[model samples]
Target: MIEIKNLSKIYKDEFLYRNFNCAFEENKVNVILGSSGSGKTTLFRMMLGLEKYEAGQILGFNHKKIAVVFQEDRLVEWMNVYDNVAFVLKSSVEKQEMDKLINKALELVELIDYVNYSVKDLSGGMQRRVVLARAIVCRDSILFMDEPFKGLDDELRLRIITRLKVHWRENRTTVFLITHSQQEGMLLGDIIYKLAEKPVKFYKI
Candidate 1:
């Protein structure tokens, strides 16, 4: 379980949050819903320790082996799909297990055929899937995704959502999905958190 207590961030004149509290369980997806500039992305960055907050406590998590899909597709331009998935991993997984994991992850995103293709050659949605593959294959208990399906069409979005739902259900991985779409959040999240101008406001669905 992940516990966030009194997590607050202040930048310049803006207060991202203050006395915020939330709990992410071990085997479910939780989403933070807010409009752009609502500091939703910053919250995730702070949780991942990518950015620091003014005051807060994050417990039961380590910096190592935590997989994330940042707001951008931080894929290496030159690396192919398979290698990119392997890139996030620190330890050298055995060949057989690594192969199986990679294959399953790629299959989840429907990118198995493009495993060897350079990420730059793939479309934005496809590249996003590669990043998804990397996060899913990390085998982490916690997965953080920021606006992961922003650009895809409905059909593509539905397909990826379907695939992700299965893996997330089976793995029982703790997931944090940040997005503007309440519909998207409703599809996979067991609970949804809505953020207002600063701290958390309310959540339903």
Candidate 2:
């Protein structure tokens, strides 16, 4: 589990969180729902140790590998689907092992057929799937997704959601997802947190 105790953050004299406390359960899909600029992303960054807080303690995250899919695809335009996923692991794993991991991830996302296709040529939905594949292939202890389903239509979003549910069931990795959609929260979250101005509220689904 991850715990946030007495958390406080400020930016340009605007307070994001103050004395906020929350806990994300282990091996579950935890969703944080908030509007844009409501400090959902900031909280995620704090938990990932990418941002510093004024005063707080985030426990159970140190030394744990993390996988992330930001709002942007962040894929290398020149790289094909397979290479983009492989790029994340190429520096650490051998060729054969890298190939296996990449293949497995693509297969899980149902994009194995497009493994050689350039990301620039793929549709928006396909690119999103590639991004998800890359994150899942890392095999990290925790996964973070920031508005991952943005820009896609409802049909595609639902398809990707189905894939994610299966992936979580198989891997059982701790997941933290930030989004603004209530439908998405109901679909993907095991525990849903609603963030507002100062205090944050949450409920189990």
Among these predictions, the greatest lDDT belongs to: 2
Tens digits of per-residue lDDT for model 2, 146-172: 998877788867877887778786888
List the candidate 1 regions with Cα displacement exceeding 4 Å: 62-64, 199-204
Q: Can you tell me which runs of candidate 2 are displaced by over 4 Å?
A: 91-97, 199-205
Each model's lDDT comes to 0.83, 0.85
Question: Clashes in candidate 1: how many?
Answer: 0
CA RMSD per model (angstroms): 2.0, 2.0
Evaluate model 2: give its lDDT. 0.85
> How big is the RMSD of model 2?
2.0
Q: Give the alpha carbon lDDT tens digit for every residue of 29-116 in model 1.
A: 8888889888888788888888988887988786635667887888899988988898866486887888889999898888999999
Cα RMSD, model 1: 2.0
Q: Give me the overall lDDT of model 1.
A: 0.83
